[model samples]
Target: MMISYADSALSVLPPLLAITLAIFTRKVLLSLGVGILLGALLLTDFSMIGSGEYLANTVSQLVWKDAALNSWNVYILGFLIVLGMITALITVSGSARAFADWAKLHIRNKRDAKLMTMFLGCVVFIDDYFNSLVVGSISRPITDRYHISRAKLAYILDSTAAPVCVISPVSSWGAYIIALIGGILTAHGFADAGHLSVFVQMIPMNFYAVFSLLLLLCVAAFSLDVGPMRQHELNALRGNLFDETKGQPPGATTDLPEADTGKVIGLFLPIAILVFATVYFMVSSGADSLAASELPFSVLGAFENTDVSSSLFFGSLVGFIATVGLAIQQKVEWSMLVKGMVVGARSMLPAIYILLFAWTIASVIGQLETGKYMASLATDNIPFALLPAVLFVLAGVTAFSTGTSWGTFGIMLPIAADMAMGSDSSMMLPMLAAVLSGAVFGDHCSPISDTTILSSTGASCHHIDHVVTQLPYALITAFISIVGYTVLGFTGSLMAGLISCSVLFVISIVILHFWAKK
Candidate 1:
């Protein structure tokens, strides 16, 4: 039974309630549950406001039936588990430590250490969770050796995590976005719409993510700093890596079976397997979609048409097997490997829990027709020229409030598509890019965001400290993105807009480099 609710301004209440409770209470899981419960109550027309019986029925039918039972959702769940296992096996086999030791031999200064951290985070692009966890685990020891502030390390980790994932078409974020946009466009009767082709085009227009990366490059290259981050870096220069007033986050010590430190292939092989396997599976699975679509198949086209679930599952599975196989070859016993897998899986509980609740909330939002309601409201009076910017702001707010970029994608993509259906392709593309950019922006800043949590957890930094140090940079990039979208709306030229935005981003970064106070 579909749990239907009135499609009006009131439909926004569920997500609003969830977002409110999350921000104030900082109890994300409980807050999201309450939000879903609130939506259920409203769906029942408030007749079941205080009735657990009604809420139970709602959860059983709406959340469980509609959201969790989906095969792709299950695939994501499995991928998360396998990824955790891979991380653990690497750690317990001493490959990660050996890799870290190898890095230490090459990095001579704090600047190089920070750059390398960011570079590794970008390179490991399979998933944001893995990026944060692995980069933080391996790089923290090296960063600490140079007295790099935990806050700075957290910022680098967080910056590279979501931004890189959002832009990389092969990342988990890519699969989610492709499915989302494709579904929306197909529903709206976009006859010639090729989701992958459009997705490939929007990469340049995803200004927040694109510029956030460029800004990171500038910051890393020039050693730029501003506001609180500058203070943190300066304090580190004085051999103070953390604030004395703040309680220090306890660092984790890994227990690993010894292996040869020279065997760096043990580390590189797993990651390489994950990337290569995913691409190979994607290409293989997409052969039919490619054959069916307008021919001349490209990598993005093949991937967008492919089975995301099977590819990701197979990729992560093979990566885990390769990792375990290497661990066994290193003379590590099965008992130790199994224990490490269990430990790694346990570490991901918080993020996994958050995704479950987020999926539930997204299901509730869909039931309420919140996205359609939003589309109707915005289209009624909002001018077409300003629509992209408005959608960008709306998406940013939703993601910031909900603390989930994927959730934001679920809620806002449909609305953006509805608004774009009748618009020209050139005009429509920026709107899509805006939705993506905003989702990433909001997720980066939200304290309850999984990426943010993982980033701090990975860096062994205080969570709030990471949020504080990262927000200014996120906001700056968001502002630039919003302005760029507005320009794209006016000019309607993808190339011109991207070039201008690129110039603006570099100028802003240069200004921060010399003028912004350290």
Candidate 2:
């Protein structure tokens, strides 16, 4: 049965409330938890009514449902744990500091430092969270040496991370797109079967993501400074980067600060291994075959069910254990080793809490089928000719609100494909590309986004500060994207739209550059 508007609204109410409360109160974790509990209560109340036994059953069903064991949840948790462990290892060995120091020796100018940060961000495009932490840690010292404000550094990191991944045909995001596109095709009655060729073909048509990438490169090349970014750049030029002694050394309190150098190579070994293993698995699994998979199990089986996050988690666990053993081997005190682990874990506490709450809220919404309901509503009211533009806006709004492009795509792609089937227009490719592009656009700008948060944390900047500074740049890129998508919808030519948008983006950067110089 179709869900009624009132019921759908009720289903979405908890998440909206949570988001509002989080924004208003500036307490993310608490707000997320409250939202999850509210959803749970609503679901239970709707089903159980006045029966105490049924209420208990509903609560149990909600808490212990097999639905919670979905692969995405497992992947997220594994990724977080691995990230925590790897970060700890990096902190303990001081590899991050060693890398930072080495970078400072080569990068002598502010522009060079900023460019290097952007370059690194692009290199680690596989996962936005990984890019954020690695880029922030390695580039922080170099940017500091050049007096680049943490805010500006964070802006660059945030801008590059998700946008790069969205356009890249490799990475975790790539897998998600393949899955979403396959589902979309089936829903639209496309006979292409299980292949991801359609998605691959649409990549070049993702005007927003492609243009956003160009914008980042242009900003880096021209050194364009706009809005709050201008103030940040000015502060950096005046030699006021970050005051390390202000709050607490990241990952350490004032009373129990550890030296920045203990065992650099030992710490980086695990992450290196993880990179190697991920590459090796991807290669061994036959990249083309995995990309062509029809179901989750096909991809899983290709990799022997060894997901990257799980592999990294286990690798990190080993690395941490080995690092601790090495400390013992070097006659370093066990207490010191334990202290490092504690400090590292503590540093990750905020990220961990955010992930937990984000996942819970996402799960709650999924259970209530909020995305499906929204998709139905959109398809019903939106016209065929306007679907591409409207889908772009809808995807953007969902992504911005949810802070997860994958989640937004998961929700919208099927509906968009279904809508396209009924439309008289032959703009399905354009519409699909718009959805993908718009989702990343929103994720790029959202303050609560994991990538956004990680970018700020990585750059050693205040999170809100990074958000404020980067907003103008992201909005500018988004504006260009909107115009580009509009052209593509009318003309049905992605190539022309992309070319036009790229040229305009480059010109905008050039103007901003000259203005910044003034």
**TM-score against native, each model:** 0.77, 0.80
Measured with C-alpha atoms, the lDDT of residue 316 in candidate 2 is 43
Q: For candidate 1, lDDT tens digit of each residue in 323-377?
A: 8888887887778777888877765565566666766676666667765565444
Off by over 4 Å in 2: 1-13, 20-25, 33-94, 186-194, 232-270, 278-308, 318-335, 377-383, 514-518
**lDDT value, residue 87 of candidate 1:** 69
Q: lDDT of each structure?
A: 0.74, 0.65
Model 2 over residues 111-145: C-alpha lDDT tens digits? 88888888888887666666776666556657777
Clashing pairs in 2: 93-263, 93-264, 136-458
Model 1 lDDT-worst window of ten? 247-256
Cα-based lDDT at residue 165, candidate 2: 74
